[model samples]
Target: MAKVLMKGNEAIGEAAVLAGCRYYFGYPITPQSELPAYLAKRLPEVDGVFVQAESEVAAINMVYGAGSAGARVMTSSSSPGISLKQEGISYIAGAEVPCLIVNVMRGGPGLGNIAPAQSDYWQSTRGGGHGDYRTIVLAPNSVQEMADMTITGFDLSDRFRNPVLLLSDGVLGQMMEPVNLPEPNDYDINSKKWALGYRGNDKNERNLCSSIFLDNDELEEHNWHLYQKYQVITDLFSKGEYKDFAVEEHLCDDAEIILVGYGIISRILKTVVEKCRKRGIKAGLIRPKVLWPFPTAVFERLAKTASQFLVVEMSCGQMVEDVKLSVDGKKPVFFFGRTGGTVPSDFEILNEVDKLVRPD
Candidate 1:
C-alpha cells in the first residue's frame, strides 16, 4: 500500500513474514528484544508461528528443526545470546538446512551495556562455531535496509541451503524510519526436491541431512562437496545479490583519504565525508552492505589513488583488520573506535579523518 514509519526491529520482524517465514524462534534480549516481541504478536496475524524459547540455545534448535522440515524459519538475539546459539547455528549449517539468524549486537566480551556496537563484526564474518563452514552475512545501515535485508536473507539461505545472518547493531535495531515494505512473497518452499519430507518415496533418493561422516576419507569428501557449494554460493547469492558488490563510495576519483564504515557508523561518516570535502580535503566514505564477502574490490580500486585508509566502527577495530587485508600493503590503514555503548560522533570521525590527512 503506502510507506509507513517503523522501528528497525519491528521492520525486520514484519519483513520476515513477507519473505515467507512461517516459523520464528527466539529469546528476548536488549536492543533486539523488539524483534521477537514484534514477531510473537505479528506472525500469527499472517498465520505464522512464533515461539519464545526457554533460552537462546533452545530457540536456535527450534529454528534448526523447522528448517529441516522445510519451513522458512528464523531466530534473533543480542550478542551474548547469539554466542549461545553458535552450536545450533553450526549444526544447521553442516546439515545444509536453510534458515535465518539475526544479531542486533550490543557491547560485549561479556554482558556489556545495551547501546549499539559493531563489536560482533569478527564473530559474524568469521566461523563462530566449530567447523569449516561459512555463513552469508548482510549488514544493514538503516531501518529500510534492515527490512530489505531480512527478505533477502531468507531468499539467500534457501537458495544456498545454508544459514544467512542479518547483522545489525543496537542503533539500527532500535531506531525508527519510514520504509516501503515489500509485497508478501508466496514461496514454493516444498519445491526443493531434497527437502526432508518432500522427497517422494524412492530408495535412492532418501533425504539424509547430517554433518557427521565417521570415516576420515568420507568426511573429507563431504567437506569438499560443501566447499564447492560455498564457491557456487559466493557466485550466486553473494555476488548476485550485490552486483556492484554493494560498496557505496563518494568523491574517490581524487580522494587522498578513504574512510570506511558500515551499519550505523557509516550513517555518520556520510556527512563527515561531505563536510571534509567541502573544506578542500579529498575524503571519501566506503560502506559495505554485505560484510562476509567483505567487498575487497572497492579497496583494490581505490588503492591506486588513495594514500591513506581509515576505518571507524563502534567496535574496537575488528573491521579494520579486514580493511588492511583488502588494502594488502598498498596503503596505510588506520582505525578509530569507541566501545562499551559509545558511538563515534561526527566531530570525532572528522577529527580522525583530519589526523590521516594532516602533515607530520
Candidate 2:
C-alpha cells in the first residue's frame, strides 16, 4: 500500500473502487461533486460502470437494480438529495440487498446551503424512510477513516445483506489528507449464497429480490423475519454492552465535563479538550465512530463519573438527541451548535465548555 495525498471526497471514491465496487450511480451536488467526477474518470480506466443519472431517485433505483443482480454497487448524495433517495433505500432494505450509500451531508431542512452539517444524524441512524429496517451507519472524522470505512462498509453490507451508510459531511468531503489506500479487497462476495445472478440449472432454486408484501399478515411476518435477522446481526456483529467504545474517548478518566461530538466537530473538540485540560478543567470528549449502533454503552459508564456533558455539532443539534438518550439524564446534557455553513471556532467551543464549568 502506498500513501498519497488526496481530498476526502476523492479518497471515498477511490476507496470504493478499491473495495471492488464496479457500479456507481450518482447525481452531482456540491462539496461532493468531486467524488462522482473522480469516479467518472477513474471507473472507466478500471472497466467499472459510472452513470450520472437524471436525478437522485433514478440513481438509487439503478443501484438497487445492479445490487440485485449481484454487483458491487454504490451511490453518493448530499442531505436533500438523500431525502429523495430514502424511498429507494427502504426498497433496498426490504429486498435484502447489499449496496453502499455515501452521504456527504450539507446543511438543510430544505435546500440548506452547501456548508457541512451533522444534521442528518437522525435520518441516517434512525429511519430515513418508513420501515423497521436498519442501515449500518459509520461516521468518519478524517480522510483516512473515510477510505478505511468504505471497505468496512462494503463488508458489513454484504455480511448482513443490508444497506450500509458512510455518513460524512462537506468538511470531510473537501478537506485534503495523506492516506495509505489499501489493496483492492480480496473479499469473496461470491460466498454469499443468497446473491442473485446464477447460471445454474433448474435444479437450483432461483434467487428473488423483492420488498413487496401485499398481504397484511405476510408483511407483518416479513417485518418479524427482518427483526430476527437484525437480531442475528446484533448477536454476531453488534458490539456488546461493554463494547461500545467503538466510540473515541479522550482524557475522560477523571474529567468533570465531557464534550461529545462527531465527524469534523468532534475533531475540533479534541483540541478544545486539550486546551481545557491545560487550564485544569478536567474536560473529556466522546466521539462516536459508528453512529447507528451508537456508543450508548460508553455513555452509561461515563455518566457515573463526569459532572456534565456538552454536545457540539455542525447542525442546530441533531446528534444531541442520541446523546441525551444515551446519558439518560444521569448528567445534565447541554448543547451548543451552529448551522447552515457556519463553523464554530476553537475559542467559541472553549467558551461554551467554560460556561458549563464555571459558576454563576
Candidate 3:
C-alpha cells in the first residue's frame, strides 16, 4: 500500500465507495460539503446512487430506506445539519439497521462557528437523539484514520446490526494527509442471506423491515435483544490508545496525577508529556480512541493507583463526565478545557497539570 495525500472528507467519500457502499444521501453543510460533492462526482463512475436530498431530515430517512432494503448506505453532515438528522438516526437504530454516518463536526451549540472543535463528543458517544441506544462512534484524529475508520465503521455496523458514527472535527476534515488505500472487495447487494430484499418465491416468507412494534411485549423483546447485542459489542470492541513514557520507581509507576485527553489535543499533550518528563514531572496520557465503550477498565486500574486525574478536551467538560463515571470517585477528577472553537495549547494543559501536581 502506498500513501496518498488526501483530505479527510474526500478520503471518507472515496473509502465509502471502495467499501461497497453504493448509496449516499446527504445535504450540504459547512466544512463537510466536500464529502457529498465528492460523492456526487465519484458515485456515478461506480454506478452508485447519490442523492442530494432536499434537507438533512430527508437525507437520513433516505438512508433508512436504503438500509432497510439491505443496501450499504451512508450519510454525512456537519453539526447543525446532524441535529436535523438525529430523529432519523434514532429511527434507524430502533429499526436495527446497519448504516454509516459521518459527522464532520464544527464549533457548535447551534451554528457556533466553522472551526474545528470536539464539542460533539457527548452527542456522538451518548445517544444524541433519544431513547437508550448506542452508536459505535469512532473518533479519528488524522485524515488517514478518518478514511480508514469510515470503512471500518461500515464493517462494524453490519457485523453488529447497528449504526456506526465516524466522528471527526473540521480541522481533520479539511486537512490533507498521506493514506494507504485499501483494495476494493467484491460485494453483491443480493448475496447476503439476512438482507430482506425483494426476493424469494413465496409471499408468506417475505420479511418486513420496521422499527414500529405495536405490541408492548414485542417492543420490549426487541429492546432486550438489542441490549444483548450491545453487550456482545462492548465486550469485543472497547479499546483505547495510550502513550507511556519511561517512569522510575515513583513516577508513573506510583504517580499521583495522570493527564487524559483525546483527538488532536491528545497529540499536542504527547509533546507536553515529553517536556514534563524532562523536568522530572510524572504524567501519562490515557487517550480514548473509542469514546463510547470508553476503556473503563483501563482507567479503573489507573484510578486505583493514581492520586488524581486531569481531563483535557475542547468542550465544556463533556468527556469529563465520562471520565468521572469511569474513575467512580476513586480519585479527584479535575477538568480543564476550552469550548466553541477555542483549543488549549500543550503548555496550557501542562500548566494546569503542574498546578494539580504542585498545589500550594
Best of the candidates, TM-score: 1
Per-residue CA lDDT of candidate 3, range 1-360, in tens? 678899899999999988999999999988999999999999999999999999999999999989888888999999988889999999998988899999988888887899878888888887789877889888777887787888888888887779998888887888888998899866667754556765753654676668888999998998898888877777675431221210111234555677777777777777777778887877777777777666677677889888888888888888899889989988999999887777688888888888888878
Compose the digit string of candidate 2's lDDT tens values, residues 1-360: 878999999999999999899889999998799999999999998788999999999999999998888878999999999999999999999999999999999988899889888889989988599889888888899999999989988988887789999999999999999999998875454655666766453668888899999999999999998889877765543465424435788999898999999889888999999999899899999988888777777888899999999999887888888889989989999999998888788899999888779856
Instruction: Provide the lowest-lDDT 10-residue window in model 2.
Output: 236-245
Q: Give the clashing pairs for model 1.
A: none
**Over 4 Å off, model 3:** 198-204, 239-256
Task: Give the distance in Å from residue 273's predicted Cα in candidate 3 to where it truly belongs.
Answer: 1.4
**Where is model 1 more than 4 Å wrong at Cα?**
201-205, 236-241
Report lDDT per candidate. Answer: 0.88, 0.88, 0.82
Native-to-model Cα distance after best TM-score fit, residue 163 in candidate 3, in Å? 0.4
Q: TM-score of each candidate?
A: 0.96, 0.95, 0.92
Top candidate (lDDT): 2
For residues 104-137, what per-residue lDDT tens digits would candidate 1 score against the true structure? 9998989988988899988898868988888988
Could you tell which candidate, 1 or 3, scores higher by lDDT? 1
Ranking by TM-score: 1, 2, 3
lDDT of 1: 0.88
